[model samples]
Target: MEDAEIIRLVLAGHHEQYAGLVQRYQEPLILFLRRILNSEEDSFDCAQEAFLAAYRNLNRYSKEYPFRAWLYAIARNKALDLMRKRHREVLSIPDETMVDQRPNPEEVVLAKEETALLSEVLHELPEQYGQALYLRYRQELSYKEIAMVLQVPVSSVKTYIHRGKEKLRQILERREIRGGKGQPIMEEIISR
Candidate 1:
């Protein structure tokens, strides 16, 4: 059933209908929280909290936007709350399976080296840009959806994602030079 239909059913007193939505989004939401929180236990806890928050606030949901985007916003807020509360930084490598699963046969497979390089560069970026890029590419969310998740205007989302990609490209270019001289600079900045 479409999200709108399920939402209508849930709001109409068939609360059991909400389980389908939870089952559908929990895996992706947990993975997203894991990347942000870097702790498996915290991520799972936040995922549950996000779902509960969404359920409690479902009356405010609008079908004009995708339900997953709304769920993502709640999850993102939960992770940010934990970040502020815990004073933690450094994103652990996201699970190999965390990327979106929509089939696209022509997707280019990155070498292990390239994947590691990308992950490192992504983790190096400021949290805002990193999150915009992660939500865009990793979760395959649309620009509008990303705006919803980040609670920003669509233009800001565009600029953040554009700058994030440029920054990542610059980092990669620096690392591509001979003799591997980029390590010192990368380590210096990332160690903070």
Candidate 2:
């Protein structure tokens, strides 16, 4: 069923329909939360809280807005709340070795190393830029969708993406310089 239909059902007091919404968005929501929280446990908790909050506040959701975007806005707020409650503690990197579902060992190792490095760089970014990059690249959300989800103007979204990419390039260049490498892995990824 479409998200709007499901949401209509939810608003009509079919609370069970909320579970379908949760199931549909669980993975993406968890992945987004994991990127922000850097802890699987915390991400799971925050995702659940977000879903529950959305369910409780369903009546307030405007039908004009896309349901998924509204849902993510709730999730983002929940994540920010969690962060604030925790006094903005720095999240540690997830253990790359634990992600063992790889078909090729060599490729898995390379991917893990690259992921760790990229995660480090992403964490160093300002929150808005980091979120813009994550939403654009990781979630594969379009510029319009990201602006809606973030409740930002489309022009602001464009500016954020442009500035974020430039900042990311600078970070990669610095890494390459420190490592005595000519170009960073990001250059290769971008070129492709």
Candidate 3:
């Protein structure tokens, strides 16, 4: 069923319907939280809190916006709150064991290196820009949806995404060169 339908059912007191929502969103929510919190345990805990908050505030959900976006907004807020309470910076390297599944050795090694670079660069970004970029590319949220989540104008979302992409490109280019690479052979793929 569509998320809207599921939400309607959930709000109507069909609590079982919430299970479907949770199943549908759990992975993305967890992954998003993981990127922000950099800890599997914390991500899972924040994801649960996000879902519970969403459920409790269901009456305020606007049907005009995508339900998934709304859920992500809640999740993002919870993750940010946790980060503040911990008094730590965002975008640290995640624990290796926290990965949901293992890749082949070669793939895992490459992924770990890339993730470390990305994390370092992401930590350098200002909070709003970092969050916007992560939400846009990693979580695959639309500009409109992101604007809604961040409580900002759509134009602001576009500006942040544009600037964030430029910064990320610079970071990647510097890393690639330092690692003894020339222009990305997969320039097309990277651009995409």
Top-TM-score candidate index = 2
Give the runs in model 2 whose Cα sits over 4 Å from its true position: 89-101, 177-192
The stretch of ten residues in a row with the least summed lDDT in candidate 2 is 177-186
lDDT ranking, best first: 1, 3, 2
Candidate 1 backbone collisions, by pair: none
> For residue 170, what is the lDDT in candidate 3?
76
Measured by TM-score, how close is model 1 to the native structure? 0.81
For residue 74, model 3's alpha carbon misses the true position, in angstroms, by 1.2
* Candidate 3 local lDDT, 36-90, one digit each (tens): 7888899999999999999889889999889888898888888889989999865
Displacement of the residue 98 alpha carbon in candidate 2, Å = 5.7
Return the number of clashes found in candidate 3. 0
What does the lDDT read for residue 81 in candidate 1? 89
Residue range 27-114, candidate 2, lDDT tens digits:
8888887777877998899889989888888889887667777778788778778888988745333444464687888777766776
Kindly report which residue stretches of model 3 are placed more than 4 angstroms away from their true locations once superposed: 93-104, 175-192
